[model samples]
Target chain A: MVKKTSQRISVASLDDLVNVAGASQEQEQQYRYHICICVAAGCISQNSDAVRDALIAEVEARGLEDEVQVKGVGCMGLCAAGPLVRVDPDGIVYQSVTVDDVPAILDSLENGPVEKLILPQDIPFFERQQKIVLENCGIIDPEAITEYIAAGGYLALHKALTEMTPSEVIDVVTRSGLRGRGGGGYPAGLKWVTVAKAESETKYVICNADEGDPGAFMDRSVLESDPHRVIEGMAIAGYAVGANKGYIYVRAEYPLAVERLELAIKQARWAGILGNGVFSTTFDFAIEVRLGAGAFVCGEETALIASIEGRRGVPRPRPPYPADYGLWGQPTLINNVETFANVAPIIRNGSDWFAEIGTEKSKGTKVFALAGQIVNTGLIEVPMGITLREIVFDIGGGLPDGRNYKAVQTGGPSGGCVPEQFLDMPVDYESLREVGSFMGSGGMIVMDDSSSMVEVARYFMEFSMTESCGKCIPCRTGTRQMYDLLSKVVAGEASQSELNLLVELGDLLQNTCLCGLGKAAPNPVVSTMQYFEDEYLERLVDDNGSADEPAGES
Target chain B: MPAQATAETSAADKRWKLVEATMRRNGYRPDALIETLHTVQGVFGYIDREALKFVAERLPVSPSQIFGVVTFYHYFQMKPQGRHTCSVCTGTACHIKGSKALLDDIEAHYDLKDGQTTPDDKVSLLTVRCIGACGLAPAAVFDGEVEGSVTPDLLHERLDNWLAEEDEGNGEEN
Candidate 1:
């Protein structure tokens, strides 16, 4: 296979490859209107595939197949009302589309946009988004490599292999100020530099796709929508880190994402984009997929490494981090799926372009899976430092059913809930931590006034209790104790002393857990206690000093 | 190994051969334990004692450690399953959207608990957390197919039909 194709394109072919491919594709398929249906997981659940088929059939029946082409693309981000269909060149998007309404949609293509059926594209939900990670999403056929090539995929890899030195590649990422998007906001450049400078004969790069955070689908969407982009990003990372082998550790629960990624890898290999002498260079890199069997703690780097090594997925203390010693006792570079997704743009458009998008400290955009009680429950990528108020009210379409907003939980179970008072706070790494939350893998769940804060705390505590790897005593027993205490408090059976004990235990878990899973387990409990202590007081037993009464009569 | 050439033992021989092939494909290293287990589960729905021992021997890991790895992960099933399986999402979003009610409804219908199989071996029910489809809260994975926004009435009807179809097929087989 290597000998059959010319790898001699090398550094010289880097500049013209993508431009030539994209130009030819645009010239060949110059349709008047392109009908793109949202075939992401959210819309697919609402039977978007049938709606897509109906649109194609309608176009074919009207003999407008050549004029109008219907294609299935990734998430359009307005998932609460789906299946969403967008007509390109006209910019008319229809929401909650059904097979019955396909004719009216096609008719609107001829006459005018349907008033009731058309979703307002001018709304902040679509307008306020700064999409760099999701640049080609919802616009390209993910299953086709030619479409990816036409969309300028692998251009960064070609340029990096041909133009930039390994250290120069690392410097560009460092200047971009790109932090890790997988919960922890560690600087990705520092990690890459350490791995690049590691004194080892063999090194490995890992793309952590085990998106275990509840309500987070950003990684899955990226992989499903533009798998080649992640591949290109990873290939570029492999080049910069001086590693020739890569592994993508994705959860097995996402069967669709796994299938698409497998296909993308195969296509890249067949096109000579993944194998040895990629872009006609001497560098040889191959990627393999490893499936995680439903372990939440595997999202932790050490635990993920253990899972990849075919052992019980458990975390060890850090010092000899994966960069220094990892994956069968060799130097390994690990980054979140979203972190790698941001690599190509930084390399192609230059670091200054990316550094200008977000806040002064947190550069570039962040993709979040906005869901729960929000009217526009879907995936969205917005610039860093965007306010929670803007994300929830403007982008998320606020609460549904005219309900009053209560609080929004960010970073899944590892994060805290921010009350309406902090709605205007900018959503950056420092701001989130200041509010007692960490940007954990981009799951922002909105809670309405109908929700009970105590129950929410108990829910996250239960999650932590169940998902604790039980490798150490503190996490194993501490999460269980905290969950029990929260349950008792929720049931109105806890004394004031027990509530105090719950607070103390939360502090204990905060300071003394083995891994991030246990360390951040008590975030929900503490944050709810901080903001909604009145709710807890209301749920407490009577203060009459009776048998059921709490002793502390504060 | 070639001594067992009888037709009666060919099925077992073929299963062993596949297990061997999967182990070899993974380079027969201990690092391929999880992948090997996944392949074994793909071939056989549940990892039985024989399967675990076979994986341990082929991957060169101790049987006890193999058992530890299998028990550590939530996805691995140790016992044989019923004719059908259904997993209900109990994540926070699903819980807020009344997944508990759906579970209660299923419990009443099948006279089973959250992680139990009916005495007739017709169905097994399990509760999981957030399958990443929060847009469709109160979701369920029935035989590995995600069905979202599931209501009690809808779930009951679907499960009833699924059971009836299985029974009809069983009746025909008989």
Candidate 2:
């Protein structure tokens, strides 16, 4: 009787936790200077903790402990210049802060600013970036529920629940021109409407945090920096899509991200944003975290659903999409982290406000985990219609050490490489697709002059081939064969016939592959062939097989 | 304590008997000891060489198979590790960008090697896969910290502090 009573109490508490919403507006306004140190997975590995310690020591040493509160925050997106530390309420952003600079920063804290460490707002990198998704990053302590509330975190969910209907929310999202940031560019609102109208007794909302794109850390950053926002977004999604329960399918490799998210879920439940009747409304919602076992293919929706169900991570043919039948044969709505992150802002600020920022086709800002040879590499959230040149040159601060830009590989292995000629192209979903690249989960790897195009193509193909789930013949066989041809080309062993065969195979795989993974696997090879065919031709061996032997080969 | 001892004894006795039985069944050979050990480890998560040798004494396969298989996968370990293991990426990209300096700082400060554990068995330092953020090169993984673009000065200060806190925790436990 005692155990049963306790269980009932626990269930009631859980229900109360989920239903609670609306961050209490009452917060202390006593000014305390915040020093946010980037402790995202990327910056932490770089010893950002030391930077934090140094800042704290400096503050204590100067006896400014009362005046300032030093804290560890999530990624500030300028990953190339980590460990990033930002001083507020001045909003003086500092990049690549080392232990040696701590004393100087503290000394300047009293009088003015550390001019040397200050990230000038006028700089192209900061000027060009129109941060929306990353607005809270470097501004608030990620773990603090109150800080998130103070920043209007749960207001969108509150508004959606109290003011709008499910169809109304979908209509706003659809009218705002938001598409899936998961590289598919599918209409997000339309997808949600389909799941809502599917007449299923049970439905699921899954946040695709299993970001497997190589060189991409955008989703991970969001999870680490502001987990509450994602929870709020997922809650909003749950309310809109009629999903009683939600699952965040994150990779096991992201332990920090997972830890923070788990904490956020607990906090959200406590705040009454996640569990039973959210925001005092009749709508019910809950979320569970399903960890992926480090399978790259699990990023695909069907495979992700399979992995969630405790099955081997693999993709299946579409027709019955996850919206129609998913997660234990129930209708499901799956959206990437970035896509979900956009929900609250759109709801709070209105659709027209969100739509005014980018191109007609693509609305709002897109976050890119800017990586590779580019300078100022990190997480960057920029307006959608911003040109590739602005992202690569202005926001990215161009290639490191004045190296000439070769090509920018966007959308990971599945996305194509845009050559220097297309640098001026506006980086929206449509514009990127026009040049054979899709804005896949926002992984932009900028290559310099030293980066061999042929080698880059082979590298991406190798990644796709290894990650292919072998669900369909075209992808399973086609990717491996293309990888072999690219490898031969890299080794200067390929004849003209092999090159033609590679192109032929690329086209075939694009058309015939069962899912998105296989369909887009040949993107790297296709784009490279389109732009750098000469590089492939140059690698071709002559009639004599002796030329096929790579340099230094026995 | 007595129950634990009995369980251990029974486990050891059972494993020994199984090894002997399997060896007798398979026609074991002396040279095939390591191979048999690897096969046993593959089925299980770890290797008990006595069981391995017992299997080897019966099987036709060479012991080299066991050694080869043990060394093949990154997951398999020859010995148990400390509670917390830190792996620093020293790939070509990471190496070029001062990862060597950071590694050296960690080694000198902690008195560790590529796969060596601390004297107290609190922390172990190892080298591993690229950690995949080549853009933020010079990366390290503390348990699973996934820090990127690390430098020697920062590594020394942070690692020393972490180690000191760990030592304090150890003292409390004792």
Highest TM-score among the candidates is held by which one?
A: 1
Please write out the lDDT profile of model 1 over residues A433-502, one tens digit for every residue: 9988889999888888888999999989889898999988889999999899889888887777778999
Per-residue lDDT value at A77 in model 2? 73
Cα-based lDDT at residue B162, candidate 1: 65
Give the C-alpha miss distance for residue A70 in model 2, angstroms. Answer: 1.9
| TM-score of chain A taken by itself, candidate 1 | 0.95
lDDT of each: 0.85, 0.74
| Model 1, residue B109: C-alpha shift (Å) | 3.0
lDDT of 2 by residue, A407-511 (tens): 888888788889988999898998999998878988787777777788778877877776777779998899899999999988888877778899899999989
The digit string of per-residue lDDT tens for model 2 on B64-110 reads 65444334334346666765767786433454355667777777767
